[model samples]
Target: MLIPITREKFEQLIPLIATGPQYAYFWGKLPMVLKRLLISVVALVVIFLLGLAFGEGFYFFRLLFSIIAGLYWFWGPIYWASRRNLEIRRYKYSGFWRGRVLDVFVTDEIVGTEETVSNRGELVIVENRERRLNVEVGDETGFTTIMQGPLRRTHKGIAEGQVVEMLILSNQPDLGRIAKTSDIYIPRLNIWVSDYPYLQRVIFAQVSSQLSEAEERDYPDNRAVINRRRRR
Candidate 1:
């Protein structure tokens, strides 16, 4: 008999799960605030340089540039920072895993499809077997090529009733459409094994270590890898 897992328990495990380097590279790193600030400063400097060169008495132009820069410096950081925070929270609070074939059913049929882009992807929609979640996987150029190659052949050849493992994320228990699939893009590692529990643990530990080092270096603002390290 299979045992049931609780969402609360799954959340508690997030801090322990290790994140892949590629995943970390995209999600972790310098706070967006610093990035926006840097961009704004560079833009203003460019505007000033242009004003100096032309000497067209474009003081108004300089002022307009400063205002635009000011807006970006203030709002852009907030936007990206909020987005990053939301992503982290979603991962922390609403992530889960299961070992099952992520069925990619092609509901719509087409003919003579040389190049096809469909809304079809892996939809992580499971019922009470676990929880209802909808994790959609879109086709990227590289992934599409692989799908049409050896992977497709292997996938087709898998024996009926064979079980494969998949990681799923969902917000609701009854409705599977609300889930997002946990797709880790790590080229150096096998994508199939990316969601393995052991790998997740390693990634989280490495991230924690990186955060610790950043804190030790006293680079709070630039510390992208570590979150809330000073308190730790």
Candidate 2:
């Protein structure tokens, strides 16, 4: 089952900041109004200086200033604006969608795994090595699969099934069809986690939890045997 998402819920679930480190720094620290004001002020100053140079008949100086100002005003904002606009548009499309998980399937492909090893002078202690699961989630409309590790990187041995709610974008819902998993984004993590919300939530929550278990089921005593021999 898939349901529609509301603006309020989507705002609460998405991350506070959704961008690269440089932009994230601004997003995390400053409000949107302040960001806009700062950029506007800088742009005006650049324009003012360029105007002054041109008025003074300093063609060489005006040209140099114009080039620098043009790059900053044109390219910088365009880059940031494009990224922000795309994210906003994506959320708008997905915000109205909600659905339930009907089935879960494990894919044969293994994305990656996480392991921890502790070593002593003579004995090498291997602790946990968690395998990543690739999963496919089926809904009332269609199936959406995740290409990355199904479980959170932090949760190693927990083989939990997908049984949660999610949001989906309907490309042609009038015809009773749904979009692909790749076209969906999990607002909770502010990233694409397939079109399945339940699976995304499980993996994301696992990453935040303190559950640690060995990836391998059995650990033989011989595996930890120390290499101790007297010099002969």
Candidate 3:
């Protein structure tokens, strides 16, 4: 059964969806990066002090070892932290929701398209509907490209007017303002995924189940009220 959802529902779902598996995968790696950076800084300071106190003979070897150890400690954590921050920024604006079937439109021509890269070096392409509707989805931090493989290509072909529910990432309006004239204008909408068949199905099923339980709990039958009304 198709559950009717409001704009409020969409707003509520945004935070949950943003913090889901797709996001956790990125965020979980951040702490490791921070740890690596901390280790690197400490090692560099220690090596410098050791060289100053011990003189030339062992200093070069100690410095080299510290550099190597620092790289080892730093590489993985830095990579993961950067990726997590990027994902957080991307989804900070958008979320997923179930909505009633809206009107669908179609177009033969392709509209606007842009491409960006994730910290993992994965490429993401964003395309917009040609209509000048003031639709905003993501924030200044940017959007994480969620789809992979063939599914991404399928969305690339989305026609002009479609009623499909979109996973959109839009900016927070309160943060909207031009900080500097030459600053790159981060559009309010950062990332959107208009097509993801399996993920959509799973998320909708979970939401539907939760909503059903909530509705049942909130609306119980009242037999006493019915009989009293009949007697009156």
- Best-to-worst TM-score order: 2, 1, 3
* Candidate with the larger TM-score of 1 and 3: 1
Per-residue lDDT of model 2, residues 1-232, tens digit only: 3444444544444433333432432343234445555665686577677677668676666567556654553345445534543454353433223232233344444333434444544544334333434434445555554444434543232222323334444445342454533223322334333312222343433322211112112333433321110000
Any runs in candidate 1 off by more than 4 Å, and if so which?
1-24, 27-82, 88-163, 174-178, 184-232
Model 2 segments more than 4 A misplaced: 6-133, 140-142, 147-152, 155-160, 173-175, 180-232
TM-score between candidate 1 and the true structure? 0.29
Show how many residue pairs clash in every candidate, following the order shown. Answer: 10, 10, 12
- lDDT score, candidate 3: 0.40
**Best of the candidates, TM-score:** 2
Alpha-carbon local distance difference test for all models: 0.40, 0.39, 0.40
Clashes of 2: 10
- How well is each residue in 66-148 modelled by candidate 1, as lDDT tens digits? 88986785556345444443464464224222222233332222211233344686444332221121212322221110111
Name the candidate, 2 or 3, with the larger TM-score value: 2
Give lDDT: candidate 1, residue 20: 42
